[model samples]
Target: MVIQSGESSFGRDSVTRATSPFLPPPVTHRKDCMSAAVKRYRYLRRLFKFEQMDFEFALWQMMYLFVAPQKVYRNFHYRKETKSQFARDDPAFLVLLSFWLFVSSVGFTFVLGLGVYEFCKFLLYVIFVDCIGVGLCVATVLWYVSNKYFLKPNYRGQDVEWGYAFDVHLNAFFPPLIILHVLQLFFYHGLPILHRTQVLLYPLVPLFLTFIVSLASGWNIIRTIMDFYHYRV
Candidate 1:
């Protein structure tokens, strides 16, 4: 009796619970774990089906993440209420992230004047090592820590899913990835040192190097003046 009670958990209604014997249950009758497994399986399967993914909703979520993150949370809440899970069901956001990573790598290739061999190597490292590998490690560590240390004693049959943790990391990574990796290249063009290097590498540009260098380097003098008169605040 005690063993049976220990195995049981309060149902969603909070009045009673569905339980089983100490032995394994038959496959014909699905259990709580199987339902979660099915959800995970379906989510992974959708990762390969680009046409079936909802990319428009994913882009909307990305935009709102910067403007109004609360609106995105409301959608997450709705999904949990309807689907019984907080992890995403579609893989569109991940696809978009990968797309941006590829585009950035390509831009760097020409900007750096990388050879064909170097370009291929750089592409592989950024996509696989820098992004996917780091993401997996971070997701697994946080998932274990959250489940092990944060769980309430009374909250039986409840835990954080690993997929949800990965989803969270992806959401947080998107903005910084765009700002730092994609946007910083533009600023480099306006910097004196980088502009000189660019002019040397591409002689097709009609601008004189001395004129470009003086114009670009004036920012240093402006910065020095600003530093001398530090703001009172």
Candidate 2:
């Protein structure tokens, strides 16, 4: 009787092991992992605008802004119609490019090279001093001027979003900034210093051009906002 009982107990143990509830099926485990990965990928796509702007389109838009400002502006509307309102025209590429140009300009200023410490300091100054303070100050002025002057004539009592103003300002800055840096690379190095107080001539041209273009685009941008509010331009 004892031997028979032992054999029965062993059989029960084998059955339990074979059909354990804690052990997930192989196919189920793979599906769960794949689902998790897909979810993560979707989240990333939304956060970064990965699906909206591809590499070629991004390059074309930035270049097109100079040659055809009106066309570029129109493209923004097309994107809004097709994509969500939150989908922006410039995307992450331009923003990254702007920062790259700024840093490269600073680095190129030093003919030799930068040490680890100096490089770190330059980066900090670019972010905090140049980008945060100066960039914000310029954008704020653009926003204020557009709202005060242009929008009032067309769309009275409607306030323009700072985001729109900032985007326009940043994009306007890119071409001029690139031109200034190119001058810095070639001409600025060779020019003789006239006086301590006088501004460098090579960069002044591009800087002035940048300001004019920014102002004009700013007006157009305000018009866009007015149109968005259902007001006639």
Candidate 3:
């Protein structure tokens, strides 16, 4: 027998309950959907309130992503324990990521000595193509793949959340964003060994990201960088 009940999410109103041997789920499911909508509405309302966001924790997450990534994985476990959700409830990390994205782009503009027009183009590519475009495509694919093949049969009514999948992408992207876009600028002119290092580094990027840019997959970062190098030379 299934039980049916309606309770106001906004108030401590009484829940009127009824039970039947063959009650359909549509009615109860609607209440659940409405509750989720309320929570989502409240979350969006907090997005503009900077003081309410936990930027300190988000910044720690960014640093630990490189130093101790397992810690970041545990963060979700902790959230699941406390909040019953594997995805982040706060958007502070996302806000910090956007901040770093622009900061790194500005460094890239200066290090590459791009003109005003070129900088504008590069900024658009970074914002639209490199980050959002790639992130959305990768996150959607992984979300589908994980739910389709990776989920355990025992876990009913619990699959990979789309938001958690995107969070995984953000956590993974943060380190490379720092290394390639931020730290690389420091070595742009100072590194005399970069030319020699390419012979070794060229193979690493593609090899490390084979699932992403294997010869069978798509354009590889190392290959693109080499093409640019040859063009300049």
lDDT of 3 at 172: 85
Please, what are the lDDT tens digits per residue for candidate 2 over residues 166-224? 55666676677667654556655453655554464678899788769979877565666
Q: Candidates' TM-scores? A: 0.65, 0.49, 0.67
- Candidate 3 structure quality by residue, lDDT tens digits, 1-233: 32112212211111112223344432423423323455457667877889988777787678778777776676676455434456677888888998898899889888888888988898889878888889889999999998998888888567777778878888888899999999988877866654666576688776677755565666576888899999999
Rank by TM-score, descending?
A: 3, 1, 2
lDDT of 1 by residue, 70-158 (tens): 76665655455444566787888899988988888878887789988998898899888877788899999999998899888886467
Considering every candidate listed, which one attains the maximal TM-score?
3
Please report, in order, the local distance difference test score of every candidate based on alpha carbons: 0.70, 0.54, 0.71
For candidate 3, list the clashing residue pairs, or say none.
none
Q: Which residue pairs in model 2 clash with each other?
A: none
Segments in model 3 whose C-alpha atoms lie over 4 Å from true places: 1-40, 190-233
How well does candidate 1 score on lDDT at residue 6?
18
lDDT of 3 at 152: 88
Minimal lDDT window, size 10, model 2:
1-10
Angstrom error of the Cα, residue 172, model 2: value is: 1.9
**lDDT of candidate 3 at residue 202, scale 0 to 100:** 82
